[model samples]
Target: MLMENLLRSKEYWSLIEHGVVTAPANATAEQRQAANESKLCDLKVKNYLFQSIDRAILDTILTRDTSKDIWDALRRKYQGSTKVKRAQLQALRREFEVLEMGESESVNEYFARTLAIANRMTSHGEIVQQITVVEKILRSMTERFNYVVCSIEESNDVTLMSIDELQSSLLLHEQRMKGKQSHSEEQALKVSNG
Candidate 1:
């Protein structure tokens, strides 16, 4: 996907999609020039692919004559069968459904863990939306965040709330809780010392 995006950005994706352009012997100078440019772009794309992979993978694809060949080879080698992909997506969905914030986990840690799984699901073709992620986090937070979660849900249109906004609100509440806990500890220490 990244390679496709990169090629698209450079306007070189045609080389991958349409294969190499070959100008016939009767072609005009303009047509020959266009073919030459396409060949050059194809080489550039191949170079990018070569630079991105490790030595082991590069060795396997070294014989590939064109960027499209390399791309197809990598895709075939890495993209599992339909059944494998379906099974992986199913497992990810189950994991996402069961995910919950740990009692000792901070807001950021929980978000990171959830987002990681969400990203994996997306890569596997699951259409995970920001609202879905926000709702999941709100519902899966530890018991201590229950009141805040309720307040957020009651006050905000959760369907429109961004993941960043929800994260910031929860992070602020987490910080305040930590501050109060530390202050309470300090007060206890002062009383015992006295």
Candidate 2:
């Protein structure tokens, strides 16, 4: 039992060689800093990432067909991972595909359409390149959000930094963004009962 507990423990670093999870090639330091600067909740950031892609795809598809039934059918085809972050990205991808397919574009045409859209915008192409990129960005957003949220929920997750301590870091971030010393602002902390 003791051995099993040690094996399953998060802190139990061992010789079991896990594959290195790499960040995206295009994920520059500047982009990462900016992403860190605009710290929103995980769910919010995921949707923000998807909004433009979904709109462009939807427009392309609508040019071909306009059936709700067909749109719904197509959404399920490309939906992302069902667990946590990927699942959310997949949901947005499905929404975009549904909108795009609404215009009756063939699968080939769909890829072509996306290529055209990507060419017009720098970011649209990059986000779709690898699943790892999505995970990396989402992981950062989730970590910061959860840390702050956990600080707010002190009864549980006591391992996380305390609320007052996290607020100091948060204040520094806000001050840096504003180019001024921290001032009084009522920032609500997220508390989850779950």
Q: For model 2, state the Cα shift of residue 64 in Å.
A: 6.7
lDDT for each candidate structure:
0.93, 0.37
State every prediction's TM-score relative to the real structure: 0.92, 0.18
Expressed as tens digits, the lDDT of each residue in 3-114 for candidate 2 is 2244336332221122112335688887666444433222232333235346756555444221222233344444333454454555556544433322333333433444
Highest-scoring model, lDDT: 1
Root-mean-square deviation per candidate: 1.6, 26.0
User: How displaced is residue 6 in candidate 2, in Å?
Assistant: 47
Cand. 2 TM to true fold: 0.18
Stretch of 10 with least lDDT, candidate 2: 12-21
Best TM-score among the predictions, by candidate number? 1
